[model samples]
Target: MKIAIISPGPFSVPPVKGSSVEHDIDEVTKMIDPEHQVTIYTRTCATYPKSAVEENRQFIRFPYNGPKPYLRRIISHIRKRKPDVIMVENRPIYVLTLKRHFPKIPVFVNMHSHVYGSPGMISKDKMKKVVRRASGFFTNSEFLRRHFMKTCKIPAHKIHAVHLGVDVSPYQVAKIHYSIRKIRKEIGLKPEDRVLFYAGRLMRAKGVHVLLKAFKEVCEQDPLARLVIVGGTGYGSNRLNPYVRELKQLAKPLGDKVKFVNFVPSAQMPLYYQVGDIVATPSVWKEAFCRVNLEAMASGKPVITTPRGGIGEVVTHQGSGFLIPPKDWKAELPALWKLLWSAPSIRTEMGKNALMRAKQFSWYATAQGYLEVFETALKKRKAASPPTKQDLRKTG
Candidate 1:
């Protein structure tokens, strides 16, 4: 099948850093069956070319001056390509427009977050139209599927839940152990330090401030406890803001116990994962499906995160990792930190279980899930389509 995938338009396909939706698109496209011809429509970057082909996939880049221009460029190319199906990533409005232009073609939208589907972003009437017009809808988690059903009144049958995945090869135990010592030394982490890692946007919604408060308590109790905060205020952005300044103020009391590493590239994330004894993604917001949890599990480290949204689906409570409720994080985080720090056996066991669980969610599985949705949608479209002139002639 010839597949056309439309990116969210804000970020490049192989995202520079910090766009999980783009990262997911890039990974899934790479893992898709070689027999299928895949074409990706994404925003152009200075580092990338206008168009390029790799294996069975082709990438077409367009300048994203605004949403109108980007859509115009993609629509022009898509009309020429006439792919078997079209998959719009993280943009519900695009599905409505694309389906209007190419009514016969099955256009599907994949919702990666609640931001686009909310009533604030798109009206209830338009969302209803999207549900009625689009061939199918895909979400990163069951939580999000239910969310759309409630918000947009979409039918259960129209929405399908396809979980995101991680590339577990680089995070294998042997590879991590080999480079961990060097990485730790370079980061000035002492051998005795029990590092607690946080990698995501340094925003209050992500619960970074909450984590800092909890970590401050942990540090007072355990001299070896350390916290490493990764990522910037936004994707590909490390510039300081009010929230960042506030975070610094919060961390000041803890002093050198907290180290902030701003905006590491996605390619080098595996190395950063190795530097952590445990990974924490204390997001207070309902994350659709966080790749950080998967990456940490794949790295053979137990994650301490809230069970909000699809995180519960990814991290098993007390089995693979600890899932503290967002409200209880202030009280529970320090306690869990102490438990994991004091008991090496429990941490090791959970880490092993985490690695095992991580194996089930691979890029291959993610790609196959997407292909199944596309194929099913295409088949349904063909079945419902009107008979061609050739079919009438054959009957005559």
Candidate 2:
């Protein structure tokens, strides 16, 4: 199969933190490289160093990612390549443009998340329209698959699930130099402090506010408890993100119990994970899929997340981690505090179990899943094509 994938932002391709969507494209493209030809159309302000570009795959950057202006360029490129399959990372603004631009090819829209929760750039109604048109579709989790079906009225038959994978090997329980004490002193840990970490976006949907509230309660229960919140500024988000200010005020009465890091590079993430006694992902709204949960589990740290969207599929409460009801952090507090006070031996056992669970989902397996979809698309496309003019005369 000859495949073309369209992405909206800079090409932060494989072995890097290229956002979740890019990770999906890179893994799938790598998976099918031996059997098929793949091309990824990315939007980058700067070009990739030639030494880093892949030999088998092609990456093309464009001027504008939006449709009204970029559609002609995309059409021209598609005409030149004439790919057998089109796998687009869909956006509502580009649906009609795609309908006219790549009219005949088999287009599969990989809907990683809906625009329903996004503050701007695209509306929910617009996303629904684009999702409804794509003949083939894929989602990050079963929870998200259900959301797509419910919101867009897309039939379940057209969609399939291909969960994202993380590099689990980098994180281990071997007690490396970046141990909890090593990270604690760097972050200014107190003598009796207990660290409960929350990593990822500080967005409303991420439920960080709820985690802070819960941390306050935990602090009241045990004075030594400290919570660290880590994430980056929103991508193209206009909302006032002085969360560090708000969160500090909220945690103020509780004393020195909260700290925030706006950005943490991928290389140093495992060390931070090594410092966490228990990881929390307290999202009020349903998560499309929580990659951080898997990352925590793989790093041999127990996770506590709500059972919404595809997160429940990974963070099995009490088995691998805890699941508290949505927006009910108080109820979730006791279980979390218990883990905080538990023996190091008990926590280590849970961490081992967590790592064992995370090993099941890997990039290697994720790649294979895409191959199944690509191969199926190729077979179906071949079967559906009508005979050529020369064959029509033979049939007559």
Over 4 Å off, model 1: 173-179, 389-396
Q: Cα lDDT for residue 213, model 1? A: 85
The Cα local distance difference test for each model comes to 0.89, 0.72
Name the weakest run of 10 consecutive residues (lDDT summed) in model 2. Answer: 44-53
Cα deviation of 357, candidate 1, in Å: 0.7
Q: Which ten residues in a row have the lowest lDDT in candidate 1?
A: 171-180
For candidate 2, the per-residue lDDT at 185 reads: 80
Cα shift from native, residue 107, model 2 (Å): 0.6
For model 2, which pairs clash? none
Per-residue lDDT of model 1, residues 1-396, tens digit only: 999999989999889865888999999889999999999999999989999999999999999998878998999999999999899998898877788789898888999999988888788789889989988888989999999889887889888998888878887744536776887776678998899999988888899988888888788788898899989988989989999999999999887889998888888888898889899988989999988999999999999999888999999999899998777877888889888867889999999999999988978888898899888887887788898999889998
Cα displacement (angstroms), candidate 2, residue 264, comes to 1.6
lDDT of 2 by residue, 1-396 (tens): 777777754444442442666766776676555667777776545435422347668776566655555556666788999987777774545555777776667777777776532437567676566666665677878888877677667788878888877767677643475365766787777757777999886677888778877777777677678887767655222244586457667777765577766566556677778777789898887778888899899888878788877788887777778788766786668556765476676677778888888988877677677667767877886688887899889999
